[model samples]
Target: MRIRRWSTVSVAAVMTVALAVVLWSSGAPQGGRVVGLGSVVPWGSADPRSPMAPPPVRGQAGPVVGGLSASSVGVLVVDGGRHQCSASVVASQSRRLLATAAHCVWLDGAWRVDGATFIPGYAAGEEPYGRWQVDTAYVPPAWTEANSPIEDVAADVDMAFVSVLPRDGVLPEQVLGAQGISFSTPPQVEVAALGYPALGSYDGQSLRGCVGTGAVEAFTRPESPKPSEIRSLDCDMTQGASGGPWLAGPDADSGRGQVVGVVSGGDDTHLVSPRFGPAAKQIYDAADTAALAATAPAPSPSTDPMSAQIAPRGGS
Candidate 1:
């Protein structure tokens, strides 16, 4: 998930409420164009995109308790390099698409197009299986431009999808497998949030959460926020919890969860999302095309490792 790396700002002088609004409304430029704040930037943005800024808070709030299902989430690393972000499997027809915050995948100006990897079901700082290399990532076009965080550019289109492959070119089904996706739902729906919070380890000292919630339609954004993708959640998430998944409904077929929004940023104690707006629909369409191609040829049990998969994380 995304965390604003603090410089030397002091606790007493830290402007919690004010900065949270500013950070939430801030934006940047990418791909030689201006983008809105809260939008995901490619790895190429220089100084345009900023981190998911949050207030100096203790833990996340709202319908939260622990974190998410480890089996469905993974650690997103830049180019198989150091771990920097988090992602969750959303669509798995062929392309192996993942859902996460736009900022988590994009940085500076370029979209970390290379050496990116996904370690599925990683636990306790352990990579039981090898890391899976990413093939490509998709970000909303509007987010590529620069904008204002206070305007709420991110609360809307904060989510993105990526295609991945094993370092050895093995199919995703050969390893941890992929998840399913759904759209066509109304707002203020119930969902379960999942992700990896680097700040909180499995250790007792670290406050990690794998929680669930049935809360619906927490709050809506202003008419014209910056990036226009952000929405508000009462959930209690913390730093290192950005880019998590806000699953909409239960996975009756795959037994996994349907993604409605991506955790992008929040205030001192709550989580924020990009309302699962039109941008999300656009990305999902593209991702569905990619996934279909990846699993071409009618997907047979012998040929398609995911054919028998009723739903997410390889169950049912």
Candidate 2:
């Protein structure tokens, strides 16, 4: 099974416009703040000859192979079915929270609010766990109010928290399970970055991943005013992989790891993510708090006459 190709051209055009806006607003360099040190995870030695090494293979990057990692990450579709970005289920008080890059949800001075659905465990056109609608998205004010797209400032707050609506009385976390989230952990942590990159060799149907040690690097664009520290690793993940999870800890395979960062952007050789910091924590706290006030009951599943008659009873 395969999902249709997403409109990469349209998204790229929009991003280009956003970049122009940022460049036009560029000014004097600003100092960046340290988010905090991340806890180091022993992921063994880095393999230089591994496929996850530098000089990534275009389009031949991440292809979902199944496991707890595949089940936790999903494609974030926007504009009523167009594949947009990647997202993951993260542990939160509401059990309905999702984490992704802020630019994925909000770009060009506006938010992509309607017709958003998260297909967890989505692979080869099969939605293993089912789809959940996004009810709300939360991003930091810094990202929303920035005059220019400062790399460091953007890296500092390039994150968003999304609230998912339940389907058939089942929350997304209940169906797909959730990964723990952490902030201010040490750098050079071993992690598994997962996503559905739609560019190059990827068709956006299957899940994909790259495992390596992630370290914080300061990035400064020629048009930008100052440098920003972003978490980076030698992964070949491309555009469609944006907003994917950077999982850490020894139990990453069992999906028992903490999400230290999200896939923000990267070149052909490396992937970058904004470090999970105080700003990200505040957004998560707000989303979890809002979830407590949502009292809507889950909608009942639709009944199909022919399928109901032929379907087996007492089965999931």
Candidate 3:
């Protein structure tokens, strides 16, 4: 069972998006390194590695790897690196949008306000596209108002989007290429869940993935505010892999795909995500609108949305 600090007593087995990042951080992380805006920052308590639980298997997930697809997907270090989660760039007009789990942006009663940095193509301490700072976040109001996500209604809205400050006047999407997103897709379909897993049998160094058929999942707790049904599939990704993207029709060459869902919570056997629907579109638009109204990034030929579409977003 994935026990966390949700309550005074333990509950059923479920690996939450931000569960282990907050619980198992006591162990010395893989490499106590601090990175900010592409430079290795001074090591201290603010180190993002401090929050990651050490890999349990002598790196059983195999050697570190990197690729173009990983350019749009990155690790999110928030709250002064106290929390680590996965996130990815999503196609949008403003070219600065990213989708992740609501809990990754807001958790334990408040938003993570200290600081948040997104590192794309991070593998073995290498920052391929450099680090981008998160400027604003937009989450479902229903998720924020819920005192506890123990209810289906609240859990179903556990998605969020954030606008990141561009580097060198170029938006992230223009540099890494963004992935198309769809909200009307059905639950049952083929999917490729990608992220950086930092736990037993895996190492949080490179881009990792699991391919499977995804379907709707139901929560039958039989209580008031019972859990809502989410998308589930056979996957072993855990903890740091949260907020990772579930890609549909993934391209093996370009590493791009249409995003359908994100990694939310599941057990050792499978993973789950909020079914992207009207609510997701609402928030996506909200974030996009806000970014559009902000300062424009340095223009490039790839500014056209169709020019550089490559990867999808996630949940953590």
Candidate 4:
């Protein structure tokens, strides 16, 4: 199914519309230099003996209550009103970084450069912290160059970091608070995956979460040089949940933990993510540098919501 792109529609209309686009395109690409697979390295310390645990036997879906996850995680409205994805605020040097799935930013052999906006603590049709516009998106070169229709190749480098334009001279991290990110950790670590899945028994109106142990899995295709290893969780989140943060720790309430991965994709019973490692770190570093060097645009006259259709929340 072709994913709908947001058009010149009003914000109120876009929120209530049923925008269920296909998860991703899996057709042959025109042409591009497919890069050979590189050796995967851990993003931080590792322990091969990390005990393997069972999948998240319990899960919850609805509006986030109150806590770090509730405040830091948000929904992404891309290309004006065409596409929607999940994203979260990750701690960065520039204090303006967001983590999400690469497909959310790049798809169909090109970047979806129509105006992208993020709404943290989005519930139903409410925007709590306001809407922050995306400024720059950093995706792995492997994803951009690969021409194979195999989802594995794209999944290997599925992660991305985006820089958000500040609202009212305030950075996103400052507004939403940031979650710590970690890499190179052992497999089978317990984590909580959060997102706004807009498919299946879901309506993309609230945030959902799944807590489970993550296992390493490998996928190989004939056109690719080698198989790519990724992390997997037995969560039923679909579509709009792409790019949700996978937090590692024993407590899901406090929301104080390291982000080990992001929602990449899944079948009917499991969700997948690129194991956070060297490739992901590179993208994060590049986004940080770009955000630090970015110049803020001049502030424009504020739009009054009292006269507009959508109610004005926060500063959006």
Best model per TM-score: 4
Query: Which residue runs of candidate 1 sit more than 4 Å off their true CA positions?
Result: 1-68, 147-153, 166-170, 200-229, 251-255, 291-316
lDDT of 4: 0.63
Off by over 4 Å in 2: 1-62, 147-153, 219-228, 253-256, 296-316
* Tens digits of lDDT, candidate 3, 1-316: 2222211012343434332233213353442221110111222221133222222342122222334456888888876676677888999998998888777777656676356889887776678788888876777766666633321223456677888877888888989888778897765877777776665544566666776677776543223255555676666665667677878875622346877877776545667777888778877876776677656432223233322211112222
Q: How high is the CA lDDT of each candidate model?
A: 0.45, 0.60, 0.61, 0.63
TM-score against native, each model: 0.60, 0.70, 0.73, 0.73
Give residue 233's lDDT in candidate 1 (0 to 100): 48
lDDT-superior candidate, 2 or 3: 3
Which ten residues in a row are the worst by lDDT in model 1?
Answer: 13-22
lDDT (Cα, tens digit) per residue for candidate 4, span 193-257: 88877655565666777777777766543456666667777666666787888888766534557
Which of candidates 2 and 3 is the stronger one according to TM-score? Answer: 3
User: Positional deviation of 173 in candidate 2, in angstroms?
Assistant: 1.3
lDDT of 1 at 7: 15
Sum up the clashes in candidate 1: 63
The local distance difference test score of model 3 is 0.61
Clashes of 3: 7
